[model samples]
Target: MTEVLFYHLQNMALESVLPPLLEKSLERGWRVVVQSTSEERADALDAHLWTYRDDSFLPHATWRVADAADQPIILAIEEGNPNRAQVRFLVDSAAVPADADGYERMVLVFNGDDADALAAARAAWTDCKARGFTATYWQTDERGRWQRKN
Candidate 1:
């Protein structure tokens, strides 16, 4: 069964939070696909990942790249997994894809301060549970450490 995780971001920006998670995913030897809500967002994420940290590097490309299959991470605005990733990260209120179960894990990263994002994350949580996926919720503590809530 696919393990679904909901990451609620309250005081942090996605740009600050995502790179480390992506790096950790790579450390686990998991290929990743980050699905955003728009082409512009995807492009921005692609660029950010490349320069997020001076001491780090993430091997990635956009879905439009000819060698997408060869990348460890791929930024996309749609459902298909062009990179054959084992994990998928959904950002910017991106919906849970219909093909959610195709991956080993699905992560929904939402802005807690955004009303629409909170609502969408709630709905996605319900949907994942109904589909029998092992869904878990996580929130950052006062010091920005992730603590699993449920």
Candidate 2:
């Protein structure tokens, strides 16, 4: 199955998502990869998700292009939010590209708020689509698992 997720992080709370998402994904035998728009954002993600800076997600997030073949990868978008404890805590305002060689499977996890963040993620998604990879912007609609541009 091919997938690309651009869900909204309403309030920047790990409790808001992460746990259930990661648990469910990993259980399904998927390898995860994370990408941050900036080094600071990557660091913050490390501080928040990995509980340490030298962890898998932490290091992978910094990589300009990360390929996790035979594994699921998560590219965490770093929107500059001040309050780390809450969502909407996007501190910096620029979004960088997350591109690299090798591998074709990816799930771009990003906050749906900030225009910049959305733009950056969209670019990556577009790249995914261009590369002939199964790509789509997904969200929960009235039913479930909505993927299609409207």
Best of the candidates, lDDT: 1
19-52: candidate 2 lDDT, tens digit per residue: 4555455566544545444776656665565553
Best by TM-score: 1
Residue pairs whose backbone atoms clash in candidate 1: none
Candidate 2: residue 52 Cα off by (Å): 13
Candidate 2: deviation at residue 22, Å? 1.6
- The 0-to-1 C-alpha lDDT of every candidate, in the order given, reads 0.93, 0.44
Off by over 4 Å in 2: 8-15, 50-104, 141-150
Lowest summed lDDT window (length 10), candidate 1:
49-58
